[model samples]
Target: MTETLLVTGASGHLGRAVINDLLDAQKVAPANVIATTRNPENLADLAARGVIVRAADFDDPASLEKAFKGADRVLIVSTGELDLKSDRRLKQHQAAVAAAKATGVSHLLYTSMPNPEPVSPVLFAGDHYGTEQAIKASGIPYTIFRNGWYQENLFLALPHAIASGKWYSSAADGRIAHGARDDMAAAIAASLASGSKESHVYTLTGPQAYTTNEIAALVSEVTGKPLEVIQLPDEALTEGVKAAGLPEDFARIIVSFDANTRSGRIGMVTDAIETLSGRKPRTLKQFLEANKAALLG
Candidate 1:
C-alpha cells in the first residue's frame, strides 16, 4: 500500500503545481495523493485524473480533519486572508495545524515565507510565525519551508509599471532572492515525497539575489520596455498602489513587502531549492527571458 499524502489548498496555484509535480515528476500514484480545497468543484479536473479531491477549509476544522485523515504527510499551504484588523489568517493556519496533529499525520510540511521574524514589518509575518510556533508545539515531525518571494510576483507591479514607465517602490537598495513559483512547488513536492522522519527547516530561494534596479534592468532587457525603479516613501507608495485601483488593505500589504525589502529582510538567498529538487532553480534573468512576451504585453 502507498503512503497517502494530503495537500491543503489544492485549488491554488502553488498547491496545484505541487500536485502536478508529484504525479508527473515524482511519479507518485494519483490514488495516493489527496488534494484538499474549500471548493472541491474547482478541482474537478484533478479528481477526474485519479487524484483524490476533498474539501478542507482552513476555517473549518471538521473538514480539515476529514480531509487530512489517513495521510502519511500533510502540506499546509499558508492561507492568504490578509485582514490586519484581526488574526484571521493566523487562526486559520492554527486550525489546520491542530487538525493535522489530531488526525495522526506523521510528517507535516508548511509553505512559509523566508525569515518569518516575529517583529518583521510585513503584515503577513505574524501569520507564518504564529503557525510555525503552533506546528512546533504540536510535536508532529514537520518540515518548515521558508519559501522566498516568487519571481512571478513581479507581474503584480512590473507590468503596469512597464506600461507607465515608473515602478514605484520602497525597496531602496535591498536585494530579493525570488525563486520561481513552479520551482518552489517542485521542491516542496520532492520534500513531501522524501519520506524523511527527521524534522528539518529549509529556506528555499533563488540562486542569487538582485536589487529592484537590477530586476528592472532585466525586465527592460527582456521586454525591450525601458523601466526605472522609482523609490518612494512608504506612505506615498501605499497611496499610489491604492490610487491604481487596488483595495486599501491590499495596497498597504504590498507596500509592507517593499518596506520589509528595504529593511533587508527579503534578500536572503539559499540553495535549498536546488538541493531539495535536484535541479538548479531558475535565475531572475531566465524567468524574465522566458516570460518576455507576457511581460511585454
Candidate 2:
C-alpha cells in the first residue's frame, strides 16, 4: 500500500525539493504524495505529475484540518511568519499538530532550527522550541529535523562583502556548519518515506564547521578576491546594518544570529544527512565553485 505523504508549504523551495526527492529519488508513487499550499495553482507542475495538491492556509485552522485528512505522514515545513511582536507562527504550528492528531496521522515531522532555547540570542528560538514541544505532547511518533543554516545563506552577505573587499562580523572565533538546502531536503524525504515508527531528532549539517575567518579565507581562495574580515562588537554590528538601510528592529534581529554564533549554539555536526539519505552532501567549496558566477555578479 502506498502511504499518503502530505507536505505543507509545497510551493516553497524546501518543500518542492522534498517532493521532488520523493518522486525522483525515493521512488514514491506520485498518487501517494499530497502537496499542500496556500495557492494550489502554484503547484500546477506537481498536480500535472499526478500529485494530490490541496489548498492549506496555516492561519485558518479549518483549512489545515481539511487538508490534513487521510494522510499517513505529514511534514509541517515551519511557516514563514516571523512577526517580532507576536506568536503567530507558533500558534500556526500548534494548530497543525492538533489537526494532524485529530486526523489520525501516524507519523509527524517538522523542520526546525539548531538551537531553539530561551537563552539563544535569536528571538525566533521560542517559536521552534514551542512547536517541537507541541509535537511531543501530541501523543504521536514524530521526526524532528533540526536543520542548520544553509550554504546558500552566504549569498545574503558574501556577494556584497566580496564586492566591497571587506566582510564585517561580530562572530569572534565562532564556528558553524551549513548544509546545502536541497541536500537537507533529500535527507528529509528519505526519512519520511522510510515507513519508520520510531521518534527521532536529527540535526542535519555540513561535513565541516568553519569560523568567520576560515570562511573568509575560503571565499577569497574560491573567487581570488581580496577580502578582509572586520570583526565588530554586537552594538556596532547592529548599528552597521541599520546604517546599511535596514530598520533598527530587523537589524537587531539579524545581529542576534552573530551573537548566537559567537556563543557556539549552532556549530554542531551530524551524519544524519548521509545516514538517512545514503548520499554524501556537497562541500562548501563545491557549492562556491558551482555558484561562482552568481556570486561574482
Collision pairs in model 1: none
**What's the lDDT for residue 295 in model 1?**
76
lDDT of every model, 2 decimals: 0.91, 0.93
Top candidate when judged by lDDT against the true structure: 2
Candidate 2 residue 80 C-alpha distance from true site, Å: 0.9
Off by over 4 Å in 2: none
Q: Candidate 2, residues 140-187: lDDT per residue as tens digits? A: 999999998899888978998999999999988888887899999999
| Tens-digit lDDT string for candidate 1 (1-297) | 568988988999999999999999999999999999989999999999999999887888898888888999999998879898999999999999899889899999999887887879888898999999999999999999999999898899877889998898899999899999999999999999889899999999998998899988888888888998899999999989888899998998899999888999889888898888998899999998898878767
Candidate 1, residue 132: the lDDT equals 92
Regions of model 1 farther than 4 Å from truth: none
Q: Candidate 2: what lDDT?
A: 0.93
Sequence-dependent TM-score of model 2: 0.98
